[model samples]
Target: MRFRKRVLLYLVPAFVIYSAFMLIPLLMSMRVALYEYTGIGDMTFIGLDNFQRLLFESPYADRFINAITNTLEFFLYTMVFQNVTALLLALALTRGLKLTGLFRTIIFIPVTISILMIGFIWTLILNPNIGVLNQFLEVIGLEAWATAWLGNEATALPTVAVVNAWQYTGLMVMLFIAGIQSIPEDRFEAARLDGAKGWNIFRHIIFPAIIPIVGIVTIMTLMGVFNQFDLIYAMVGSTGGPNYAVDLLGTLFYRTAFGGVGGQVPQMGLGAAIATMTFFYDLYVCHRHALY
Candidate 1:
């Protein structure tokens, strides 16, 4: 009874904090979206006009579609590349090889750095004129292959996607490594005794045990990638430049609420609408993924 009370005591404050900070704000934002806000005067009661405008209006409608598409594209690219690369790294590192610890550290190094710093470093690396990447390509007599990576509309989004994948793959590798390391050594010994080695052992025992961990990693990566804004914002600028080819929902929401220049007076109602839509979309995605 005392232990239960102690646990409840700790949980109470945590719950209160979450409710006050996250839950309340989310509810308030939804409420704000349902109402219409003007700069100075009282807010009017407009049920779904904001959403209709966001969906059916001229400029806003296009922006909304672009934002949704860009965000989804970014999320998809991150999940596919990051997980595959991380899994490959985990497989290689988990083998009882020399210098495993050093390799693990090297893989996880990027995850330790700030995303903003990573963005800046990648931007310089992908620079068209003075960047080492282009310089190396030119030296290799493949100058045509050395076009501006972040500047090209065709490659900009994918370029950012690769950078994001590179940065987070290390963290996923570490997670998989932890999961792999937790498997019982006796299981391996038994498999070896049963003439089960190499891919056979992995396919049977190691793989199954890691599925749950991978599922967790997948959900986390999905959310992180879906909501990603900082790296793209930093590397490509907030507008997701090159004619907004990289314009993600997060960036769109920012630009919409707080107009780009001259503090053109924020449209809290529209911003709230975008945010509310994003919130629901995220909820649906999370729920769908959580089921598996």
Candidate 2:
């Protein structure tokens, strides 16, 4: 009883902070979604009307759908590019190569930098007219392949996705490395003794041992992708330019709630509705993952 009491006491501060920040704000947003508010004057209660408008109305529905599609694409890109690359890099780093520490530091450097700064830097690099990337392409006789990466609708979202993947890949690599290192050395020794090499060792030992870490990385990626805003905003602006090709739920909610985009009247209730839906969807995904 005393030990349980001590544990509960230790948890109280964290639980309080979490409730004060996360839980309260989430409940308030859900409540706000059931009303009509414009960030000023009076708020009118309008049970589920905002959700109805968001789902079935004209412009709102279209933009919401677009944001959902883009967010999913962003998550998919991160899973494929970021997680895969991290896994590969982690595998390589675990091979006891020389200067592994230096390589790990280089990979993780980008994660320590500001997302906005990274966005600005990449924007300069991807610029069509004067960017280093285009200049390099020209030098290599591939000038025809160089184009307006951030300005073209076809490439804008994918380009931003790649940038995001680059910024966070290091963190994923570290997680994977930790997972790989946690595997018993005896397992690898046994595998080698059994004539297992390279792919077989990884398939039979590393991969199975790190399944939990993979799940953790996937959940983190999913949450991060849904909450992605700053990098996209810094790279493409609040309107998610190139005709909103790069817009995600986070950008959509911010623009609607705060009127960050030109000529957009702030719709606090509708923004809250968007947020509420996203929160629930994320919750559902997390719950499903937990069940599995």
Q: Which of the numbered candidates is closest to the native, going by highest lDDT?
A: 2
For residues 120-167, write the lDDT of model 2, one tens digit per residue: 999999999999999999999999989999999998988999999999
Instruction: Provide TM-scores for the models.
Output: 0.89, 0.95
Model 1 off-target regions past 4 Å?
A: 1-9, 38-41, 190-198, 261-265, 289-291
Q: 209 in model 1: Cα distance from truth in Å?
A: 2.5
Q: What is the C-alpha RMSD of each candidate to the true structure, in Å?
A: 2.5, 1.5
What 10-residue stretch in candidate 1 is worst by lDDT?
A: 257-266
Candidate 1 residue pairs in clash (backbone atoms < 3 Å): none
Show how many residue pairs clash in every candidate, following the order shown. Answer: 0, 0
- Assess the local accuracy of residue 269 in candidate 1 as a C-alpha lDDT between 0 and 100: 80
